[model samples]
Target: MNFTVVNKNICVDNIRMGDCSSASIFLVGDAETISLSAAFDTPPESLIVGPFVPLASP
Candidate 1:
């Protein structure tokens, strides 16, 4: 494919994140092409299904 992008101005104030476990992107400008892929392969014997525990904040 072919395209054109003309970005004049972009402003980002703040981006707060706690936890992330996959592919992510934060683009503020033009891009011709973008590709993202994520894969998780866990063994059957190594999987843990336990109780939910919240993380203690500082």
Candidate 2:
């Protein structure tokens, strides 16, 4: 199922996520997991996890 909590887009937080006041996005892929916490870390932004992050978006 695709869902979102503090994120704007679709995702599935496998567990009950903590207070996502920070936009620390943890992206998990097949071979690796990349975090966008640098750009999206800490408060008021949003939490987003997905397949790919476009260069434009990053």
Candidate 3:
């Protein structure tokens, strides 16, 4: 999954991670894309994000 700020000048803050045994998260502000790689035997729960304006992925 991916997320970004509505305005390019603005950025998402207060990031937190949870509900997964192991995963790699890559955040690219220049391209405005957050990539996630999850490793688990079963489906993992959703990630949590703090209150912030969300922008559509390019």
Top model by TM-score, which number?
Answer: 1
Candidate 2 lDDT over residue span 1-58, tens digit each: 8754463455666855444434455444332435453454566656565575433321
Go through the candidates in order and give the clash count of each. Answer: 0, 1, 0
Q: Write the per-residue lDDT of candidate 1 for residues 1-58, one digit (tens) a residue.
A: 7766676888889867675433456666677779877565987798787885655444
For every candidate in turn, the CA RMSD to the true structure comes to 5.0, 16.2, 13.3
Worst 10 residues of 3 by lDDT: 17-26
Q: Which stretches of candidate 1 lie over 4 Å from their true place?
A: 1-22, 44-58
For candidate 1, the per-residue lDDT at 43 reads 73
- Itemize residue pairs with steric clashes in candidate 2: 22-43
- Local accuracy of candidate 3 as per-residue lDDT tens digits, 1-58: 6665574565677766543332334454655445656465654455555575444333
Question: Could you tell me how far off, in angstroms, the CA of residue 43 lies in candidate 1 after the best superposition?
Answer: 2.6
lDDT measured at residue 3 in model 2 versus the true structure, 0 to 100:
58
Tell me which of candidates 1 and 3 scores higher on lDDT: 1
Name the runs in model 3 displaced over 4 angstroms. Answer: 1-7, 19-23, 31-58
| TM-scores for all predictions | 0.35, 0.20, 0.25
Candidate 2: where are CA atoms >4 Å away?
1-14, 27-58
* Candidate 2 global CA lDDT score: 0.48
What lDDT score belongs to each candidate, Candidate 1 first?
A: 0.67, 0.48, 0.51
